[model samples]
Target: MPASVVASAGSSPAARVTIVLPTFNERQNIQPILQQLLALRDRFQLELIVVDDDSADGTADFVKQMAHGEPCLRLIRRVGRSGLSSAIKEGLLDSTGDLAVVMDCDGQHEPAAVAAALDLLIARNADLVIGSRFHPDASIKGLSDKREGGSVLANRLARFTLPRYRQLSDFMSGFFALRLDRCLPMIRQVDSQGFKFLYELLSISRGNLMIEEIPLTFQPRTYGSSKLDISVLWDFGVSIIHTLLLRMVPRRAVSFALVGLSGIGVQLLISNLLILLGFSFVASLPPAVIASACSNYLVNNTLTFRHLRLKGLQLLAGLVKFLVVASLPMLANIGLASVFYARVANDTLFAQIAGIAVVFVWNYAASSRFVWNTP
Candidate 1:
């Protein structure tokens, strides 16, 4: 609940605005983004809450050092758990501002756009304002085709699957702002288990939500690796499924199983490719099995048990536990699939689906119990 500010021009007080930065290994970009955001303190009351995942790069230490001088700066160093969506939620819950803006720590989001997005909340009475990269007047720099293409596909899928969100052109963009009073209730209610919290917000506020968008120029990251992977795609799919089957199943279990199902594709593709490259099925099997397990671990950590996500040494330790738990099921998957192939007459597709389904259940139960057991 730390709030800091520069003196406003008039005798009247400035409205509070909190910028929540959810970061992991973003030490290099931290100072620069802070400098930019700190420059805006004169115009509006600004507070910066950096919820970090215990970055080995000393991101939290640096923020603590900076906070000594900048009263508006606060750092929440999460030691055992980490996730972008959950980090944002932590920041939001701690924020004291009338308006809260969520942005990236990678410097991809322009700090300059924050004021304009905030203006929509204060003046235009917008329930939520998005800094849209796909806006007609927007520009982008250094965005990869793979990431951009994924964003496009995610947006399209969200629109097609959840028609209520069709009004948003950039459902995946992380930069956005809303009044704390308006968003806090929804944030508490939604399944905040995945990376795309904004999409979750939009989906939850389907009726009578006054949403607006402003053009924002997307820029390249100043430091750290992009978090995008096949797991992110799977997480997105799980979010869509969560939206579709809101009341039908336990969100975490369903999402975890869905991510495992996606990993089946990874295993099959890698194994098949190796076989095509002249490797024996025996030779290709181990790597394919391991790779699929790794994929599942990554996705489950980031999406399924996100609130209890691991970081640094804990992340590595969790992976080891995941592999140990997953190996048995991986073997079972091969055996079951083979058994189905041998017994079933013609429907190979059904056999494959049944095997995947069985393994999915096994993986989910084991992972939930051992790998990511957080209370």
Candidate 2:
């Protein structure tokens, strides 16, 4: 631990501190991190909760085995569900402590920072204390240059969503502490499906909370591979959009709209290509429409409604149901576009665009309720 990661001596030793570690296939990393956190029990009343996302690697089982001997250690095994933000939310909600700390089990988030964060939460009388990698005194020797650059860009974007905490250096940091009493109401209302739980908390607080930051020494992961990928970035982008929209629109709906826009592009591209190949505009439209609907269903399964993602036989079933649910809207899109092309605009692009717009809401609502069985 660096000198900058000093634990505050000002906090009360009797204060119950709950540390929430969200894990996914992090079997190798859990034990070491738990041991380090348990070491803090001598100074603070510590309760360690490992929220495991049904890791096939038996992460939950490992925690359960350890909990058998250690009263402070507990495990939450979530089946048929996955997502870092939700896991953290569930852990925090289940916490039986006055103060709560949320961090990663990947070993990248330094366990030593928890005490320092807790101290800041008490000493400064702040509602939330974030462990920021971008803090002036912070160090992130473990982060790659590319990852660091991406994080910097993400923090900049996050500031816009959190107008009250615009001075925050790391809106994306997984390590943070908060006074649970002040945050519980907001936590309950947080969009658990969002990519970043901290961002959701900060955004929901609307700067009304007295938020502060502590320097964090982000370490390299020693066990599992990094989960940062294109999908995570896509979710991050959607989160930003959700905040920007004043959160009036559902997060899933925002994702659906974005995916629908991509589908529109696919439809227009294929429709124009077929027309150029000597197919009549009307004849070219149905194939293009069907193709775009298929693209939307696949993308939606992977991104928009990932929590209810279908696989193997279920995936085939979902695609069939998606098409069936979409059939009426598909007909509406084609008929409206064809009418516009023949009578109103006499322009294929304009007609198709108008047609797609007409059924956008119906497709989202119907598919979500019927195919995905989600409201």
Candidate 3:
């Protein structure tokens, strides 16, 4: 133990923690890493939980051996499993501590950073305390231009689309601290699809989130190749879409409703363009409405009603169902407005109101019943 550690250990508060580190093909790095973690038992008073996803290289055996004599260490192997994000989810579901800190199994995330993250969480009451490698005060040693550029560009794009998370400079860093109850719901918001946990979390959490960029010297891993790649980037984009829509809508049929928004955009765009081309209000309205309806039909059929697509019969049935549902609103809009104007209400405002409300109920029910029937 370092002499400085001896001084701090003698004076500190306690927050019993369960440290979850997910691993795959990391046997050579396991024991040495656990040694460093064990040396800090007195520092943070943590229980180390190693979650290994059936690593083909006997990584689980390595952890099992190291954890045997160490009273604070325990091993949980998820057999026939692989994803980093899912492993952490499984670990948290099984963890005993009220607080859980997840860090990369690779040596890249320094063990000391975990201690720093915990302190920041305790002092500031931060929902999350991220160990940022790109912060000016950070002690990054082995970061290349490629890594630096990737981090910057990714965070910048995410900021533009997701304004709430933009304030955080280190959205991609996985090393962080959180109380487990708050952490569970945030983790569930993250799909099993991607490894970018922070990207997904920021989309849903409205808590008093204070992100601290604790600059730490990032050391390159001495053993094992990097798992980060293009898939991670693709997942980042997926995380953004899921996070944004999930927040805007409810679970029942909201994703389907969001798909309808694109149809609305296309509908308005085409209608305006046709009107600009010197078509009469009466003549232009039909073509504009027809064009928009056609576009909406195709989009909602394929994208919005995706969950209902299973067997050939199911898809065909769903298509028939969607057409009937979509047609009712649209027909009622122009038909009711045209008839009512000609026979009863001469006011254009009253006619337009009649059409809009007709379409609203029509679309809502069709979407609720026919389009999104999977859930």
Best by TM-score: 2
Using lDDT as the measure, what is the rank order of every candidate, best first? 2, 1, 3
Model 3: residues with Cα > 4 Å off, grouped in runs: 1-13, 246-375
lDDT of 1 by residue, 1-375 (tens): 122222232324466889999999999999999999998787777889999999999899999999999999999999866667778888999998878899998989989889888766666767789888888888878488877887778788878765765777898889999878777898886655664888877777765578899998999988888987765666777778777875366667777777777787887888779979999655666687789889989877876776677889999999999988878877876667657767774444454456667777667777788887742
Q: Residue 71 of model 1: what lDDT?
A: 96
> Per-residue lDDT for 43-120 in model 3, tens only?
566688888878899988878876678878888887644577777777777777656688888788888777777776
- Candidate 1 at 285: error in angstroms? 17
Clashing pairs in 3: 138-215, 139-217
User: Alpha-carbon error at 200 in model 1, in Å?
Assistant: 1.6
C-alpha lDDT of candidate 2 relative to the true structure: 0.89
Error of 1 at 315 (Å): 11
Tens-digit lDDT track of model 2 for 185-273 = 99999888898999988888887899899998889888879988767888899999999988999899999999999999999999999
Worst 10 residues of 1 by lDDT: 1-10
What number of backbone clashes does candidate 3 have, counting pairs of residues 3 or more apart or in separate chains? 2
lDDT of each: 0.79, 0.89, 0.65
TM-score, predicted candidate 1 vs. hidden true structure: 0.74
